[model samples]
Target: MKRREALEKKKSIEELIKNANDPLKDHLNSLPCSYRHYNRNGLSVYLESGIGSNLSSFKKQYIQKLLKVNMEAAYGPKEWVFEEKVKRKEMVAPDARYVFVREIVDNEDGMQPPGDSFVGFLQYRFVLEEEMPVAYVYELQLEQCVQGKGLGKFLMQLVERIAYEYRMSAVMLTVQKGNVFAMDFYVSQLRFVVSSNSPSRMGFNTSYEILYKAVDCEAKEK
Candidate 1:
């Protein structure tokens, strides 16, 4: 009787676990989209987009799912509870990092808005050495709605434009094969040169490609 009872209990727990996963899967599939626009004057910059309060929740859920374990399993029981607080600390509004809402201008007047607005953005990190400036795009995100509308290309070109103004010697970025659309865009549309020699540190196992566009920003003007 004891053995039979234990088997029934195990079956009930399995059913519960399966049922709980369905809703979470659906939530991820239908994540919401919030778009904005941005611009920086002359200097290369990181553009943040996709802002909303739910960004925190999204990150927590994403980390949980990626581990494929409940919070307790991932961080251990007591540790997990405390770790939740740390996770909240790491939370950022999706758009806070990339939005340039301050640049928007009101149609009623020539005045710019108090902050920049971005529909999507590419984040360029520029490093200056001596007289040379090299910029790398650490992140790029397209508003889900604005994606597939050529906004990605427009945003990328905007980065190069900023690099030109900053007198950057070169601009570069990396794209993994899983994101084939981005790879194609960088190679074909922007005319970025793909590096054949070195593998990427982060995506070593994947078909990650590094690309760069050299700018003779210091070249003497004729």
Candidate 2:
């Protein structure tokens, strides 16, 4: 409990990212250096770490746009309004952390690319679930162009790796039941199971389901 509390109180997850020997860092380094593009040799895609509170205005807008584009349908009109407001508040929370997938132009000058280069992002935070320390993924939004390319799976894998590195009990996320693709991807492909704290498990009817992948059994036991 003490260890979990300490981790929850941490201001940043950068220590793990900066550790030279951390497997999470190694895994990130092993991703494809370039994504194939039509004109250039290849567009470079890289992961960047950020805190929600520190996000630039442009990035904040981009995140909002991505969330709306990807989730509005699943949430529907009535629910979307409330959900959007909630998500906007969550996005700027002090503890929220992000892993952004960004594309770089294949140019000699290495200038900042246009907003379209922002492919996707994963937002998460450390929290206690059922008295156990866990990493809760609030959002994982990918652009349509990047869909079906295994990037979502890769991001989830990174989340699990991060959880293991931090000795978290599990990596948890919520998915709307209406989103069949997301449901299949997480439950079937990623092997996430319905969490005990989920509304369904508790005999409640809800639009979303909570799912989790246990990362450290020993940590959970402790």
Candidate 3:
């Protein structure tokens, strides 16, 4: 896309997001069905989204298992896994307005329960931090069975589009330093830069890197 066209497109999407009924509502409308399917390494994988507050107990359990399985190698302590979910339950409440993503598998006829075949999830929120609004990614995880198939990139593109549409100048996330693949994926493929205030840059030398990709020139480096 040309620079001028891209800027106009972002402006148009921003207007839609600002005028829509809910926060960034047009972004979801653009998606229509909460579900979409794509081919990954010849396997059809479905990605779906919904109001986080609407997730059922079973769905929550599915998220728990997927997160534990996908992240335990990097995060450690299965008990912390459970604890994190406990805190997440608070995040998914209605007013927090989180958008949740889950991967579903299709049956022979393409019909299945929403909670039955969940392979993973991504949780996100749009809000002002330090006086700047940004699309903050809380979590993005996929089952080991279907990972490394470009699905993460697919989902991230969706997130970036939404961020741009919502007029957020930056798309921000945190990556564990131990997760080398994730680091390379964000920095190399997605072109994310480490924020000036990131843990390592600030001398905390933490295990996490706060990364962001500027959607426009006005985006803060931090």
Candidate 4:
């Protein structure tokens, strides 16, 4: 679908909110997959379950479902987008890891879902890109109601933080050029640079752009 048409049909799920819900992380602790926490820019979030290769069947299905929901919500009826690839990677890739993100509710003084409330999720793995190890973000999707909030930045920060923690050189991700919103979000908002090896950059008319942020060594030096 064209970018203009996609923007026209776009609707935020926040329209369904009956009461005010802050799109930031909750203040609870010790939830499932809670590996790290962040308080940058007055926004808080947690890293849960640094699972490797052995993601449960239930989690795999849920991630696929969420991915489909996000894709359809963005570009209309993307029924064939995310499933087989997610399954194959999550079930077998030795370096694959899942990072589930949740929005915390301060009023309840507890987590929203199994650990915290489920607002969004991310999947990534360590891989060699251009002869250097980097954390590659396979997917990052958040609920519509939480879109404009700072949570997306927080999640990307998590990916970079993980990369630095593991001594990886950077964090990489793929975004469709047709996805104007995401392209802007990643480039303008998150400050990711397109890789020189990306398809379009290499003169091929491609659907996506490979973007990366240098982390680890550079991050630690400063």
* Each model's Cα RMSD: 21.2, 6.2, 6.6, 15.2
Give the per-residue lDDT of model 4 (tens digit) for 145-198: 767767778778766765665556778898877789899999998888888779
What's the candidate order when arranged by decreasing TM-score?
Answer: 2, 3, 4, 1
lDDT string, candidate 2, 1-222, tens digits: 998867665523334323322323333334443321212223345677677778899889999999999888887899899999999999998678788887766567665455557899989887777656678899999888777777788778887876676667788999989889999999999999898889999999998899988887743453
* Candidate 3 CA-lDDT value: 0.68
Candidate closest to the true structure, highest TM-score: 2
**Which candidate gets the maximum lDDT versus the true structure?**
2
- Ranked by lDDT from best down, the candidates are 2, 3, 4, 1
* RMSD over all Cα atoms, model 1: 21.2
Kindly give the number of clashing pairs for every candidate: 18, 0, 0, 6
TM-score of each: 0.45, 0.78, 0.76, 0.68
Off by over 4 Å in 4: 1-46, 73-92, 105-116, 216-222
The better candidate by TM-score, 1 or 3, is 3
Q: Find the 10 residues in a row with the least total lDDT in model 4.
A: 13-22
Tens-place lDDT digits, model 1, residues 130-195 = 233455565565444445655566566666655565445566776665566667888788888765
